[model samples]
Target: MTFHKEDQVLYLMAEHDLATLDTVGLKKDFRTGYDSGVYRITHKQWGEPPHYAQAYFDENKHLLLFSAMTDRGFEQLVEAFNAFGHDFPAEPYLRVNLTMVTTANEILKKKVVLNEYHDLFQEDPDPESEKVLKEINAFIALVLPDINAGRTPGIEAAIRKSGIDPENARNVMESVMGSLEGLPGPKGKSPRKSPGKSPVSGKQKKLTKQLPAQSGEGVRLLSGDDELLFDLHLYGMAGDIRREAPWEYLFEDEVFGVQVPGKDLVYFVSVMGFEGEHQALSFYKGYEGLAGFLEFRAEVGRLSLLGLPDDGMLQASTMTGGLMTIPHLMLSFTDRDDLEKEDLAAIKKSGARFRGKGQWPRIEEIVPGHVPVYPSKDSLTELFLVVQQVLVVLEKDRYDDQYLMREEDPDHTILVRVPTGKGPRFRWRDHYLVVDPKWGETSYAVRISPASSVALARLPEASQELQLDLFMLPATVREKGSRAYFPFVLMMVEKLNGLVVSMSVLSPQPDLESLYESVPQRVLEELIKSGHRPSRIEIRSDLLFDLLEEILEKAGCRVMWVDHMLQMDEAIMSMISHLS
Candidate 1:
């Protein structure tokens, strides 16, 4: 109706009347006769941009019964809905639908009121907006007949016709159907609604419970030798690497290589410190070859630009020679709880400079098999030892032949030093780390396993179903003198009613692996404690699905990966507001 020109004008004129209508009355009049959930519809006109509209019913409030037009308007409406759970201050929220602009007063109100409306096209019209509005109007006209007849709209076909990807079109239709589930079909004929089923529920293929065997071949594991390498790193190796293999002499594009004796692999290292730049050594697996190095180089270039301080005292001080810019590798860790006393002492003695409130430097090791982590004392020591070995190779003249070869063929080969054995008698042999000359020849893969499969098996299946989500909160938490980090939350809510069943917050301190590995067990504990095994669990995150799939399936629970979880999202937004 609002799409009609005369109705649109009338709606604008009746803003006061609409505002005067209580939320209950408005719901009774405008309700879509569907369960509470977000429904999206897209309209596209010939030779015009697409416009989107989303309508939702709020389970927690009386208002939130209106439809939003355009992507920006939809986003604003969602934000306002989220703000309703908290004691957010009242504010005016504006939305532009087609040519009409409406402002809502007390946007945080449980029952929202439209303050006023105006014709945007009449006063300072934007050509782009007008064009988009026209397209939206055309799309509305196309779908109005189906909507009035209570028939499912041909949204997917329309989307496909508009040149959208078939898969994306199917996803859009899935959302629409999921939201329209249990609603009446043609001629007000009610569809068969499954008892206790969620409004957003949909049929999903059952996932296999048995996990594939993880291969250990070609995978590097942390061993005692690795510990030895980290120990070598702690004995002033970073400074030695900087002095012996300066990036000024060895360009970032040139690779300095290292290989341990009796090992089948070689590591290609790039030194980055070259005055007014990040001081760090980036290592790439030799198996990855030339393209991998190029990719790493490109990522480093992007990081360098992104790492620049924003408009702040740090930027001003750096410009005025009052502060030093430290590499992100040397992140500050003022909290002693984050580090062992011995490691802290070693770091302090290592002569590493730190700024801000952090008293010691922490090394962040990002390797092939593990999550980015602040390495433990032994691990840090091993890394430093490897750096010391690299420094030794750079300083020695025995590797001159390999270095010369690498210099001549920079793209194909790298200078490498292989150690014979550990201990004081360790001897070095010069060699070249060679790779396939062609690009895209190598692939890097890492296998992750659920932390606790046993706990998953012990979970008792229940009759109820639930929506689950694990996400990092936007708000950060930190101790008085420590670096800040966003905390993660694992939440499970009753799928049908949107009631929060369980919520667990985890801190990713020391390393991300610790946090990641702890998730499965936490989910199991929460489910067992709450006495809800959930016959079916729906989730949107690939990470959560990966972590919980095998385990949950073993417990006789089906896992469904969907495009959206209405209840889960709303709950998360409320949690975020409280946290913020």
Candidate 2:
């Protein structure tokens, strides 16, 4: 069932008499003390791993609870809190958490029940949620009765009833009671298993280097060698290595580093343990991911020093700059249908399982100059080789020292293994990584035809200088079983008054190169059709400059590359907003 932002379920602790002024402080203390920070809740009872929730005291003193596992549930909570402060309305919360309401009859029953506070509103709650809820009810039931008897409400037994260990339960109770007396309590122990070394050591010690050759400027042509392109042996080896070293043994912050021999570029590998949403070996190319990671760490440190809660610090860090923007090639584990037809066929041919909804291997090539797409067979082979190397390093514990590189480490040096030769030989290279703000612009070579120059020369020169930009729209179009691509738009606007002279939607059919190669002709044809050539054309993108430079210069139109085009940016934003 679809859960909308405007649907909510409220549960009131009817067994407790929490209407008194003293109850306000008690509720506040409970919320603050028991608060499990976002993404850090280790309790198995609090929803699922990674996506969990903490209880809060709303303005009305109701126990506010929600789970991130529900569709748009987290977003709804954020929106409600933002709009109405602490007294947020309950209309926008999910009426039935599918995780809780399992049976058809329970769903039907919940559909008729009004969304109001009640002691026993939730029926057939998931085992984990039910256990936790019972514990919460027990604590609330004890609060008032024990206080009236002039005794402190000890909640260790209640916490233990929820399956927490005795020590942790005591710690939780101490934290809660200490808050009442304005004393600092010890942090609760997390239930997650500590990071451990891989059980099996990888035997492979060297990388097979059949690197792709550079194709002119800003492009690399894949090698034609059969061994380099989809080597089944390499794929099998990588898979075996991965099977040996499960991601659960490593933390998200742990990076397995690799560097291509003779190249300055480095790729940091992050093995996601499936503890969070993603299950993949993410190869964050270049310095982008490293920079983002360091920045995020620094932000967290700064926020922690200021005494902010984990969620608040994370939210603030995310708002300023998040690591999600880093460009990385992810070797994801996903269902078969999520794979492109070609990718699925490749897997099938390799005798890999592809029929069921299992976490199959899929390569997501998200790099510079291209839209996110499934890698070709050749590219997939290359990526699998990298994955193999990373797994090997992970198994051998070669990256253990690199994992120790902290914020206080003066050098910030990354240990990268450089492949020396094919016979189990490699060299360790030390590279100090830093954030490079300058982004690598994708450039395409465009040849101007004499016929096009003749046609542009025939048009009369217009007084106005026009701004031209060829950019990918935010929206994407895709066919079933095929990879998705952003639609490109060739927009021409009058630089003076922001009047749109021409706009044409260009499809990245065949490939992006073909689309880029057609841009010069398209722009020229538009100018000729308009019967007037502008004196000068202003372009912000390096790509547009590259495509239009030779053609526009031959047409007696000066091409200027400026940092910003107000008209073009505004028009792009408007179109994007409209599409969104």
Candidate 3:
């Protein structure tokens, strides 16, 4: 067997040999890379040159060494192998390895090459050899595409003459090319345009759909008098409550074609009075004596009013039978004293009680006359200060009367727009600052110059420092179902000239990405808490893809193959052209 193997190796070497060295000008062959007949070492050791000093390869895949080379040359040879080995194929391109071993000083360092036995590896004894083969196969697929295409004919002829399946060889080459074609790019896919329409339209639709309806449906608490105004003294027994104590008239415009009633919702009323030059009123004062009377606390999450409806029954709250009963149930006051007393009593006499307080007695018998309003000590002063730290209040209404004109409220009321997420803080002159909770700051100051207020009547005396208190929290709903708590800041800005302005620093908590991930969980929690939850709005999968594309573009990335991605995310395909 050993002799037979030796003979086979010898035969293979003889088949690939071209003994006579042909020293001549440069020659080229399409099959092999470069074939210059002459072999010369431009820089080698300063000694007698070898008779033959060139790389020799055999058909058996064995390599032979020869040459009078220098140490530096050998180092270059090793380095070349390493650099090429990154994506080198197991089966040598030329079927052999070449080396130059020096005998002058018994030093083998001139060049060293170990001919890797490709055929022998096929019959390997070690189990790990299979893994190595797989890796080499994968490598070949990665790096030999252009070479395979160029040498297809020679490789095919070799396989056929060797009685090997030429088709398998072709298959291997194709596989390598295919694998190389599938590598990923840095930017996965480009932004795509929608099929039938532009992405801008789709994006606009998506934005619109994502938002709550432009028209809102909320009830207002307005007085029944000719002026439709709320009066504290009028409602009080001592004098006209509008001037004596304090009151507020709420009005619902029925925007978006929805009627919102004032009585359906409970309002924690408070009165603010000037204690000298400074505006001084406790948060508890805002709640009136209701804080102690109704056992209210400073904690301002959602309040579970006892009489809210789970269904669309809030319409009845305005008609007088719904949650409005809560006040009478608690205070036990006569309806005759209320601003809505006559109208309310007529409704009550008409025979109707929205599931009467199963435990409480008739309100008329419990107590009589108007529910007296008392002042409560402010307990949320610290919380208010915390809010003031991050926001700037521009216009603060300081009215001595308990009930100020509602019409006047809009003109003098402070307007504040809180930021939604973790974002930067910017200032607009004369506008109040709205702090984003994610910013972690207590307050942000804004300077309103009178120059900017020329459009309005005139600048208030120079600039006034308006202290703000943030009470609103950031929240979002993806459709109607996905409600997320975004970090937000709340504060009132004083209106300087004529513009109602407020600035908010962007601070996103539970960012948009996280909100989408936990949409379902958040929706369920919000639903249970609100009891009167809004209807859910469903969105197409394509909308998400479109949004992603817009966000990526905004983040500054090159988009490619957008059309293909659009096809995959069909819903958003229509939004491919949208720039933002």
Query: Lowest lDDT 10-mer window, candidate 3?
Result: 96-105
Which 10 consecutive residues of model 1 have the lowest summed lDDT?
Answer: 9-18
For model 1, the superposed segments whose C-alpha errors exceed 4 Å read 1-237, 240-279, 282-381, 392-417, 422-425, 429-488, 493-501, 506-547, 554-556, 561-580
Model 2 Cα lDDT, one tens digit per residue, 1-580: 2122353322211111123222233332223232222111112233332233333333355344433544334444434333433444433223332212222112123232222322222335456545543544344444536644658766565455455334434433433332222211133111222347742234322222222222223322222111212333333443453454456576666665666443445567777764755677777776665655555565566656766444444333222223433456776666867778766766654433333444566767763333566665444544654664565565445435433243344243343544443321233433333323442344566655678789888788879789887766656677675556566778899999998999998876666667778888888788887888898899855556867787789887889987456677677667766977
lDDT of 2: 0.50
Candidate with better lDDT, 2 vs 3:
2
Residues 215-253 of candidate 3: C-alpha lDDT, one tens digit per residue: 213421221110111111112211111122221222111
Q: Rank the candidates by lDDT, best first.
A: 2, 1, 3
Q: Please give the clash total of every predicted structure, in order.
A: 10, 2, 46
Question: By the TM-score metric, which is better: model 2 or model 3?
Answer: 2
Evaluate all candidate structures by whole-model CA lDDT and list the values in order: 0.45, 0.50, 0.23
C-alpha positional error of residue 49 in candidate 2 after TM-score superposition, expressed in Å:
53
Model 1 agreement with the true structure over 160-184: per-residue lDDT tens digits: 4454334434433332333233223
**Who is ahead in TM-score, 1 or 3?**
1
Output the number of the TM-score-best candidate. 2
